[model samples]
Target: MSTIKLLVTGSTPVTVTTQKVLVARLGDEQSSHLLTFVAGGRSIIVKQTAVRTGTVVVVVSGSPGLIDAELRKAVAKAMVIRSTGR
Candidate 1:
């Protein structure tokens, strides 16, 4: 099995930050696990988890623009593998 990266865009800009914080907080409460990174001008957050499949699921729970941008990105990513030989 390999690590599967999943990005869950929250309902709002604050939500995204909050969720990430929450995840970190909970993780801290337990043990050190997983990794998170923030990137892009929109402040997109990337979360990596160990999974068996290559499917990347993006949960939308943020501002419309942010959510839309994520959806577009997801579609574009998914399309690439389908559109080209990968």
Candidate 2:
């Protein structure tokens, strides 16, 4: 588990500075994992699973667009880095 400050940009720009971000692999299945974070008094869950075509399926919950685009991007990038062990 690690903490990262993420800037969420939308109609109004806000920054989330905390240590509540959690990243973890969900199962033995490759490419399956989970990401949990806090935003707007809600818990956000981003789950990624391996598809048949060697691609990943990402499902985000909690609030639609509440995490914002920038935060999503940051989370995706971080997930990639974790998966690649970089």
Candidate 3:
């Protein structure tokens, strides 16, 4: 997929290794977000609307080390944004 948009909790960690994807929390294994890694090719023009509360997306892009720290910070900020109505 050239683009992938997934609706996952702010708690999900961004994992980028040999594969690029997101990891869902325990017991929520069926989340397709966990399997999305293709940023090169597949589908196009996909759009999503949360339609839910306390749902925010924090995207961190860069090297693995950078992404780890950035994602943590971003997610924290996103949580605040969600809680305060953003």
Error of 2 at 61 (Å): 9.4
To one decimal, what is the Cα RMSD in angstroms of model 2 from the true structure? Answer: 11.6
Candidate 1 minimal-lDDT segment of 10 residues: 23-32
Q: What is the lDDT of residue 11 in candidate 2?
A: 48
What does candidate 3's lDDT look like per residue over 1-86, in tens digits?
Answer: 33334434574443322333443331212111212333334422211111122345444444444444454455666677777887
**Could you tell me every candidate's TM-score relative to the true structure?**
0.23, 0.33, 0.37
Q: Which of the numbered candidates is closest to the native, going by highest TM-score?
A: 3
lDDT of 1 by residue, 43-86 (tens): 54443221111343323344444543454455456547655857
> What's model 2's lDDT at 78?
52
Which regions of candidate 2 fall more than 4 Å away from where they truly are?
10-29, 51-86
The Cα RMSD of model 1 versus the native structure comes to 14.1
Clashes of each: 5, 0, 1
Model 2 lDDT tens row, 1-86: 44555657654333333323333443232233345666666665654333221244444443324434343454566568668987
